[model samples]
Structures are given as structure tokens and as C-alpha cells.
Target: MIGILYFSSTGNSLYIAKKLKENLGGKIFYLPKYSGNGSEFEKIILVTPIYSFGMPKHVYDFLPKLDKSKELIVVQNYGGMVAGADYLMREYCTKNNLNLKSIYVVQMPENFTLSFSVPKFYLKKVLKKADSKILAVVDAIKNEKYNLPKKRKTKEKTYLKNMSNWYKIGKEFKTNENCVKCGKCIGLCPVGNISIVDEKIVFGDKCVACLGCYHRCPNKAIVYKNKKKKNRYINPNINENEIGQDI
Candidate 1:
């Protein structure tokens, strides 16, 4: 049996995970909600997006719990930069005793649209190309392709440094009057960093920077620090409800 454990913010990584499960017979598990090591499955894949050159906080914590005996394949998708994610994964596997078989890095449309919004037409073009690459990655995994990640000192250090910003993500976000106080973000947050306090939405420090609350907002109420209202980006291939389900 094959299992795919995935972490997605706006659906870029979810898009890849769904495609991989379509090609490779597997059960798709949401990383934050999934607790088991996946000892039942023979093959396991970790699909996620790179945040500031590193894995999301939820994915980073979940990686160590995976069963080492099963074959582990890692797939990371990013908007534009690769940022030495391969090396970071290699180091993580060594430290945690995980048997990482293959590592794949893919490019997708930039969804970080806190300030600068991406045109939907251009995002569609990017997704079209991404769809082709994802299939190729699936074939490679099927063919038993093995890869060794190259280590980079400078890039890895930068990656680690940038991760600190995720801790401050809660502080950077501010809700406008547009918010209906729907408390939707409370459910959408994978790490439980959001809640309704005193009948007001409150953000905590546990944010993993997945941006689910921002992109999946029904009223486009969440805004990043000091940024003018910009359009939010969600994967064109996946529906907003599916991403909001916290699966």
C-alpha cells in the first residue's frame, strides 16, 4: 500500500499530492491531522511547499514521526526559488533515521500574494506547466529513481534564518472591517493559531505560515502588515472548500 502525507497552504502542494495519489495507488493524509507513522503503508510520500526555503512548521514536525522502514519519497513545490530544500531534507533524514528514497523539487505559481498579486491568467499558464512536471515526477518515483541532495552551507543557513519570520506571521496579519467574524480562520489554521477571543479574532504565535486563512477567506478580510488590499492566490486546480476542510 502507498500513503501520501501532505501539507498545503493554498493548494499548490495539495495539487501535487492529489496528482500523485491519482497516479500511484495511495491514501492521502493531511499532515497536521495525521498522527500515525504510516506503518501500514509500504510507500509514503511527503508533499509540501517550501516556506522561505524550508519545510512548513507542521511538515517539519511531522517528518520525524514517519516509519523508517517504509520507503519515503519527498516532493516539495515552490513558486520561483528552489532554495536548497533538497539539502535540508537530506540533513533531516540523516538526523532522524528516515529512509528517504527520492527527492523532487517542482515549480508552481507564487501564491505568497500578501502584497503583490499574481494575475490569474499567468497562474494558469504556470499551473499548466506544473501539471506536466508532476506527472514526470510520478513516473520517476515509479521507476525507482534515486537522488542524492547536495549540501550548501550558505543557503541552509539562510533557510534557517528565514524560518524565524514564520513565528512572527501572526503579528504581521491584521483583519479589516470586512471580516464578518465568521471564525472561519479558526478552523482553517492547521496549527490552531487562530481563535475568537472576546468576540474578536485573535492570532497566536504558533503560525506555520501556510496562509490558508488568508487565501481561503470568504470575504478577503485578512491582510498582511501595511499592505494595500491585494488579491489572494489559491491553486486553480483545487476548490476553496477542499483546502478549507482541514483534511
Candidate 2:
């Protein structure tokens, strides 16, 4: 049996994981809630979004705990560029003694509202390409074609140098009066860094800067420094409840 473990804040990775399960036949495990040691499956697959060209803090924390004896595959979902996430995953696997079988990068819509908004037409095009790529990924996995790409030295080094900026990302987020106090942001936060305090949303330092709260806000109330909410993005195929169940 195969076990697919995924960490998705805005549902892009979750959508891919669901499709992988449909084609590859596996049990889907949400990484935040899963604590098993990978003993349940002959193969383990990790699907996650690229954060600052590296894995999120929770994913980095969880990697060492996985049973390294099982065959492992990693799929990274990115918006603009993957940078060095592939190399970072390979290094993590090597350090943990995990048999890294293959790595795939899928480009999804850019949900980073702080930087820019994804055009609707462009988003639709990306979704189509992502779906097609997922099918090919499933085929490769089935065939056990373990072809991992060589790391790009320059890009990887650049990503490593910029990774430290991720810590300050949460400090820029702010909600405007448009906020309905619906609490969707509180629940959608993967790290539970958002909360409701006296009818106002509050942010904590634990944020992994996934931007799920900003992208999934129903009223588009959340914004970054000097940036107004123009467009909110969530995986078109997944509903709000599917992405924000923690409430």
C-alpha cells in the first residue's frame, strides 16, 4: 500500500494528492494530523507547497520523524519558481537516511498576494497544465522511474541565502474593515497562528508564511503592508470547507 502525506494550506497540494490517490491507489494523510512512522505503506509520498524556495517549517520538522526505511517520493507545488526546493528535499532525505526515489515540481497558481495577483486567464491555463503534469507524474511513479534532477548550484545557493527572510513574512499581514469577522482566516492558518481576540483577528509569530489566510479570505479582507486585496485565490476544485476545516 502507498501512503500519501501532504501539507497544503490553499489546497493546491491537497488537490494533487487527491488526484495521485485516485491514480496511484493510496491512503491520504494530512501532514498536520498524521503522526505515523511510515510503517503502514511500502512507499511514502510527500506533497507540499514550496515556501521561500524551501520546505515549510512543519514539513522540515516532520521529515526526520518519517520511517526512512520506506521508499520515498517528494512532489513540490510552486507558484512562480521552485528555486532550490528540490535540492533542499534531497538533502533532507539524505540526512534522514530516507531512500529518496523521485522528485517532481508542479507549478500552480501564484497565491502570494503580497507580491502579485494571478490573472484569471493565466490561472486557468496553469491549472490545465498542472493536471496534465500530474497524470505524467502518476505514470512515472507507477513505472518506478526514479529520475531525480541535479541541483542547480547558483539557484540553490541564492535560495539558501534568502530563506532567512521568511521569518519576517507574517509581520506584514493586516486585515482591513472589510473583514466580516467570519473567522475563516483563523481556521485556514496551517500553523494555527491566527486567532480571534475580542472580535478582531490576531496574528502570532508561529506563522509559516504560507499565505493561506490571505489567499483564502472569503471577503478578501486580509492584506499585506501597503497592498490592498485585489484577488483571492484557492484551488478552483476545492471548496472553502475542504481547505479550512480547523475552525
Top candidate by TM-score? 1
Please give the distance, in angstroms, between residue 2's alpha carbon in candidate 1 and its true position after superposition: 0.5
After superposing candidate 1, which stretches have Cα over 4 Å from the reference? Answer: 244-247
Question: Candidate 2 on 71-160: residue-level lDDT in tens?
Answer: 999998999887667877787788899888999889998776676777899999999999999998999998987768686542545555
In order of listing, the candidates' clash counts read 0, 0
lDDT by candidate, in order shown: 0.82, 0.81
lDDT of 1 by residue, 1-247 (tens): 7888888878888888889988887778888788788898888888888877778877778788878888889998888777677778878877899988888988999977776988878888888999889999989998887676777652666766767777687778878888999988998898789988887788899877778898888888888885776888878778767763333
Backbone clashes (count) for model 1: 0
For candidate 1, the lDDT comes to: 0.82
- Most lDDT-accurate candidate: 1
lDDT of 1 at 9: 78
Q: Which run of 10 residues does model 2 get worst, by summed lDDT?
A: 238-247
